[model samples]
Target: MTAVLNAVPETSFAEYEALKAVLDTASRRMAITVVGEVNTQGRAFAVHVATLGTADPLAPAIGFFAGIHGLERIGTQLLLDYMRILLCRLEWDELLVEQLRSIRLVFMPIVNPGGMWSMRRSNPNGIDLMRNAPLSAEGQVPFLAGGQRIGPWLPWYRGRVGAPMELEAALLLRVVEEELIARPVSFALDCHSGYGFRDSIWFPYAKSTRHIAHLPEMYALKAMLDGAYPHHRYVFEPQSVQYLAHGDLWDYAYDRVRAPSVFLPLTLEMGSWLWIRKNPMQLLKREGMFNPIKAHRTERVLRRHTDLLDFLARAAYGAPRWLPQGTSRQHMMSRAIELWYRRRRA
Candidate 1:
């Protein structure tokens, strides 16, 4: 007689359950790949990738990532909600189908299921995936927040020195290389929560404040967003404007990418401090600071960000139309320097 296997504990997690449901509903339209796995508490949790649209090498692409820090459940929820919205629209929206034909959309919503399962910021190994990259800060970083080699016991640990990157980090590298990096122009939005008082959208160069080669491109994108959503509250700035950190995965990825092609990686640090101020008691709970405890608050957060996710897809779809060129590009670069860097000096 064949014995039936019991459900894995991770399968019971709400995020994983939502993931499975999305896959099951959209499997015919999406190319789902099990990129890797993380083991914790004797449970093996799968890292899933869901891709929509064409994989044309020349087509622009956008990747949406979340849950790198397990305790930041809002990140995962926002992405999952966005995916559900897209999938719901796909059944009847000809505009969406036509758009999908022109560009690629990639999702890796739950990057660190093991960490999420344990409700920890770092993975089961106690290493922060954001800080697990091989690159180091070009200059001094803020104490432990910059990343440390003080072993897994401490937060912001970078894993053992000279060791291979964590599995989640490797999988992210491979996904970007295959989807976004290969395209002529692409963007990545990695969602995170529990940062500061204001919702912020940050670009690369987390290792230093020096300008990126694609500053002009970044400025153009910011301009488009500003024009499109004038009342939007996100504070768009370079990650270094806040504080430099060691081993930022996006910075490492941007440095490794060769010239000529444009790749913009953004981190969406949702402002959980606002939630804490609204519900002051949340600060007392372990995971509360990183997530909204009330159902209505969570729904509001999801409603606010899904439009931005949709906007990125359309932006990637129409990149050639708005991406600056020649003299316009030069002017934007100069303006970017004057706006961001010069203002910092003053």
Candidate 2:
């Protein structure tokens, strides 16, 4: 843990400090690895990957990622709060102990530290990490919003053509490939904000409207989430349902990995537009568009998602119980088609 802290810049970064504190507390109980590093203006940022629970190849895992877009600090804060809770409960939580025995938990809470530190949506190089992948959208995409090589000065800049991905993006995929993709089944949640008025849980094939091969699996997880929290208001669907984009890192990673090893990468768009509607003044601030500006509002947002994170942990631990099979899986597939694809067909 000392080594991890040493690798990070000595400068004060609140999110980094919180992450270090959580890792420090859980050091004795988990494995911590400094996966990679990013440097911006002479200050180096460490990308740490922490793993909790059994390392059995057969066990399911969940990878929690936030802060890919640095301006969306709520996503990073939500993850930090969740990790803080988990670390504090380590001594007395027997269920958590049991959970650790059957599942692997991976956290990469601050993937683009430089962007966060600079209060920019893109990394230090001005490239959007999410849009820096090698893949391109299959059809016509919405100008810059869909990503472009128009250059880094503009928003949604997809890095130079044929160039390698940004360091943070590369590191994220490396961590996912090593920690989560190696398992039989895994789900990754990359949290973000500023998409729409309602919260959403989006799964991939962001490059096209084509359904991912694991739609049934995704639907089963959605069903589990819905059944567990009857009144929850998360809209679950494919990313293409809203808009298609180029170089979505999750889509690239999901495409690289094949079936039998189900890797469902989901993006949790936290609906910061609702927050903006409540406080229109937030529009004036650079970070305002993507995060809740009020302290109480931020806390409420943080509190709201802990249950979802815990549910994801439990879902990974007990995937076999509700993942669906045979006719049940077919039913989920049919339902998913009706729910997500019907509009496209219409």
Q: Pick the candidate with the highest TM-score.
A: 1
lDDT of 2: 0.88
Model 2 Cα lDDT, one tens digit per residue, 156-267 = 9999889988889999999889888877899899999965889999999889999988999999888889999988879988999888999999998898786678898999
The number of clashing residue pairs in model 2 is 0
State residue 274's C-alpha deviation in candidate 2, in Å.
Answer: 1.7
TM-score of each: 0.96, 0.95
lDDT of 1 by residue, 85-156 (tens): 888899999999999999989999999999988889999889999999988887889999999998888899
Candidate 1: list runs displaced more than 4 Å.
Answer: 1-11
Judge candidate 2 at residue 313 and give its lDDT.
94
Name the candidate that leads on lDDT. 1
